[model samples]
Target: MANKTAPLTDTEIRQAKAKEKEYNLGDGKGLLLRIKPNGSKLWLFNYQRPYTKKRAVLSVGSYPEVSLKQARQTRLKYRELLANDVDPKDYKQEQEAQAKEALTNTFEHVANLWLESKRDTITSGHFQQVKRSLEKDLFPSLGKKPISTLKATSFITLLRSIEAKGSLETVKRLSQRINNIMNYAVNYGLIEVNPAQAIGEVFKKPKKKHYPTLKPEQLPDLMKALNTASIQLQTRCLIEWQLHTITRPSEASGTKWSEIDFKQKTWTIPAERMKSRIEHIIPLSEQALALLDIMKSINGNRQHVFSSRINPKKPMNSATANVALKRMGFRGVLVSHGLRALASTTLNEQGFNSDVIEACLAHIDKNEVRKAYNRSTYLEQRIKVMTWWSEHIESTSQNHLLTTKKSRLKVVT
Candidate 1:
């Protein structure tokens, strides 16, 4: 028959004095409080391996920190593991490893990993924007939380907080980014579901606001103002290049000298730099080439065609053109992007082929098969159309100047 041991009480444990040598007070079922000669008590659990039946000891913490009742409970827990054929020491080690992994798998950590994976796939400016958004808006609240623990309700509250601040646009953009991150988490098996997948439906859609633009008739006045405005030659040339090429302000601002081809008379923006993630070829007109020649003479040695004056190594600020337009008293009336709208309107009105116009605008074709088959379907027509457009602007600007001179002469008479 097995010997029976009595359980220990808190009073009895406190009353028992330490001896000259280490001794144990039994609390039943392999739990013991070891009293040392130095007047310290330690709790320990002795158990046998389920498979090997080998003896093992597990520390349950020191006495006073771990009470007699708590020690007994821990021993009972370990006995339960033994009953299930699990070794207590091995189970404890697995729990510790899981705890460490949970600490390492925070949302911020995974989000950074996702960003690093996209570094080569996205432009530096775009990556900076995403990083800034996360640092300022999202990271403060959810960054430290485990990615697996995040739920739909967590993001719902986060987005609603952004909405409460009247940043509907930010809320929309943040929701898309969050959904992307969640999807990334799912793809990597970090989580079972994308919690942010359906969160976008909760936000109210923001009204679209088009960038204010000039009518075709207003181009002459715009051209005249640009000519007479007291701005830097580089700024004037940048604006002229944007108008002649019909490119986005960012594309124009970020243009590098390497992107241009003097022999081919074309500028090819890389897939990563373009919004559509497809390479864009801009056919250089005589006007565009002349402007490039002048720019080359001034900043030919620099990497960026439109390098910042303060930091020649970096591209010009994306807002430089817009701010210059505003300074020239065209803030509300026109924007730098307005040039694209003006070009599209004028070309469409002139009955240019829609496909050719779309090609010139670098607009992606919706039909995947067609896009793959005819990537440069309207290359020849685009070159002709761009040349014609540049000539039109030149003629219109000269005519407006002539008309102004004649009116001044009449006034003098």
Candidate 2:
């Protein structure tokens, strides 16, 4: 019959004394307390490697710091790992290495890599906006966190903090952006599951809003307001340019002289300045060319077609048209962006093709192949569409001006 080894107790451990040489007191099953001649007691777990069957020692902890009960728990865990064909010493080393790697591969580290990947794909203006959000909103909160170790709750807490500040719009965007970064990590195999995938669903939804716009019949009122409004010529030209070109405020305001082609009668907007991140070719009408001639006399030498009043070297303020619209009694009634809707309504009412009108506005398409196809496919038709819209504006202003003058003539009698 085999004899069983007795487990060491706290009383025996406390009484263990250092001798001339280091000695061990066994607590059975390969766990022992080593009392060194320097008067320190250390806990060691000696075991045989599972596959190799070689002897190995795992440092459980120091004695007084790790109580007998705690050391026993660790021994049980290590024995379970060994039973499952894992070497305790090797497993410990692997766990330590993973912990170290997690600390180095922080949230900010992975996010920056993901952000850099999107740089060339999106516009420079959009890239900077994304980078600023990372630094200002996301980074200061969870930037230093190890992405692999982060749970869904960690992000939920962040969203709640952002929501508490009453910036629901910011909260909504950051939640999606954070999830996108996590998705980037998942695709790269940095982590297994995306912990932030469901966090956005837990937050309050923001209200949907639309840009202020006008109906088709109200076109003459807008034209009359622009004609007599006490605004700068540059501002009026900017408003007219955007309306004529069917462009966004930023796209029209940031137009460079190099983008114009007098012979071709086209305005080629680069992909970097466009919201869709796709290069757009706008067919210019006679009215559009006339407006350009006026701008040429005012700012032909300057870099931008509509240069800033304060700094001619820079583009005009993007908000200048919106301000002008408000000043022309279109406040809350129509905005700068609403100019696109106004033109779209008038064109659609005039029986223009819907796809060609959308293409003129540079609306993003869900199908990548079709989007590329439509750009060239609709260019010829778009020329007539733009010309019609431009002439609509020109003739509307003339009719309104004649009416206003005739009314004044009758009042004089």
Candidate 3:
């Protein structure tokens, strides 16, 4: 029978001196320490490869650096792998490679990739907002972490910080953005699962707030106020242009003279400029057309219909309408956006087709079939609806003049 190899002790290793030849002293179960002629020591594990029975060796560490107890623990771990039909050397090498890969595929690196994909799909302003959110909130904390190991807990602290500021909407939006990035990773086969899907659920939700608007009865006061408000002529015309066309502030402010069609009596808003990322055509009423003619005399040579006072080459500041509205003593009572609501209420009270009015406002319908049908079939009715709305506004403005004892010619120019 073969003599059983005895386990090594610290005393024996401490007493062992470097020899003339490099040699190894074996501990039980294939762990050996080589004491080099140069007095260097190394711990190694010798094993047979699973299935093939080929011999292989794994380097654990240098002696004393890897103590006897640590060498024994490593031997037992390799033995466990062998029992499971796994080659310990191959497994260790694979784990090391994955560790290296994890370091390279960091959260910031992957997030940057996800952001680059959005550069063309979203508007420039929207893209910058998303980028700012990531940089401001997420990247500082979790940026260096391997995305393969990211968890919901990874984002909790970050979310809590923003939440403490009473920004539940910001928390909700960031959670969604994180989820989108993780999903982007999963789609590209970079990760097996997304751990961030439910992070937003733990936070409080923000209540939905609709735009503050004036009631239908208050339209005359607004019309009178607009004519006499201490705002600039360009601002008044811009307000009238938006009101007559029933457009969003940014869409109106960003309007180009090239988009106007005097012959078609249409103003075409391109898809990229629109909120829904779909092109919209507004039927110009006589009032809208006349407002444009007035603007042509002021800014016909410029790119934007409503050019900025500071920079004529650029579009009007989107907030100009709201600022002017605030200055007119209508603060908190109405906003530029509320003009659309007032029109909707007045038109609904008049018993016009709800669908045609909604179409004219470019409000997207959830039902794709209905939306497509409305897009095609509502233009004729929309023309009639727009004409009627303009007529109503004209009559109201005329009435405002009559209601006041003195005619305040509120025309800006």
Candidate 4:
């Protein structure tokens, strides 16, 4: 008959000294305190495989780090696995793997994955905005947390912080992004629910403010001021091109020489450069053609029509036109984007067809049915409208200049 060993005590473990040969101090069924010859102590579990019934040893942890009570608790867990016919070694390996995966499945990790998946679908500028928003706002607080642990309240707190900064629009946008990332996690089975779905209910809706624009009657003074402003001619031409073509500031600044067709009298902005993600065709007026001729004389050799003076390899800064407008004493009166509103309102008031105006502005049609068939529907009419608009601007500026000269002569007399 074999002698039964008693369970280990804390005092016995501490008092036990190492010998030349390492020995095991049994703490009953399968739990042993291993004292090595070098005076190091460790906890080990002796177990049997249910299938083959082979004996195996598993290392629980270093002694004292894993106390005697904790070692016994672990031994009980292994015994429960044995009762269920599971191999303790295999179960431990599976648990370790799951723990590692949990660490890797962090909120930052999934957000980056979602961004990478959309890289080819979104424009570089739009992609940069999303990346910056995540890095600056979302990533700092919740990045290290596991995605599965994120709750709706966690996201609401994050959004409210952004709202506190008076950036309500940014809060709305960031919330939508968070909802997208959570939905992505749900689709992959990493999480069961999207906590961000209900976050919008808590935020205050952003107030609408129209861009400051010059009225049609105000166009003459603006044009005169632009012409005489102490700015680079390249910048002056950029502002004029934006007005004549009614393009966004980004579109004007990013124009490349290759996009212009002097023979066709047209400039074709590619889909990647357009806000609507659709290609836009602008028919060049004689005025626009003359401007291009002058620009070609100066920048035809460069890639960007409005190439940066400091770095010829890149496009001019998108803010160049707006800064010039501000410098010309139009800071609160008008902005670069205000040019679009001015053209749209004036043309609509003048009884131009709404469809033609929208097409010329490259505005996306909201109605899905009409959008399917109406792309490029107003090409001929747009050509005529653009010519009329350009000629009107030139005539307005000339009339303003003549009127100003007369007023000056009257004062001199």
Error of 2 at 382 (Å): 0.5
By lDDT, rank the candidates, best first: 2, 4, 3, 1
Query: What is the C-alpha lDDT profile of model 2 across 1-413, one tens digit per residue?
Result: 87777999999999998999999998989898999999899999999999789888889999899999999999999999998998888888998998998898899999999999988788777788899999998788889999998888888887798899888888889988889999999998879999898787888888976789989998888898888999999899899899999899889999999999899999999988888778899999877888898899999999999999899999998899999888888889999999999998888877777888899999977988988788869889888888777767876685332122211111100
**Model 3 TM-score relative to the real fold:** 0.84
**How big is the positional error of residue 287 in model 3, measured in Å on the Cα after superposition?**
1.9
Which candidate, 3 or 4, has the higher TM-score? Answer: 3
Better of 1 and 2 by TM-score: 2
Tens-digit per-residue lDDT, 1-413, candidate 3: 98899888899888789999988889978899889998988899988889999888889998888898998999999999999999888889999998998898889989989999977666656788899989988899989999998888888878998899999888889999999999898887778998888887989998986688889888778888987888888899888788878888888999999999999999999887776777899999877888888888899899999999898999988899999999998888889998899888888888888999899889999999999999999888888878777767766674332122333223110
Please write out the lDDT profile of model 4 over residues 1-413, one tens digit for every residue.
98899988999999999999999999989999999999999999998889899999999999889999999999999999999999889999998987787689999999999998877766678889999999999999999988978899999988887899999989888888998999899998887888788788799999887888999988889888976789988898899899989999989999998999888999999988887777888999877887788788888999999999899999999899989999999998899999999888878877888888888898888998777655746777887778777776776675332122211111100
The pairs that clash in candidate 3 are none
Residue 91, candidate 4: Cα error in Å is 3.8
Residue lDDT tens for model 1, 10-106: 9988888989999999888899889999889999898889989999989898989988778878888999999999999999999888778778888
Please list the C-alpha lDDT of all candidates, in the order they appear: 0.85, 0.87, 0.85, 0.86
What RMSD does model 4 have? 6.1
Query: What would the TM-score be for candidate 4 when compared with the true structure?
Result: 0.82
Ranking by TM-score: 2, 1, 3, 4
Q: Give the TM-score of candidate 1.
A: 0.85
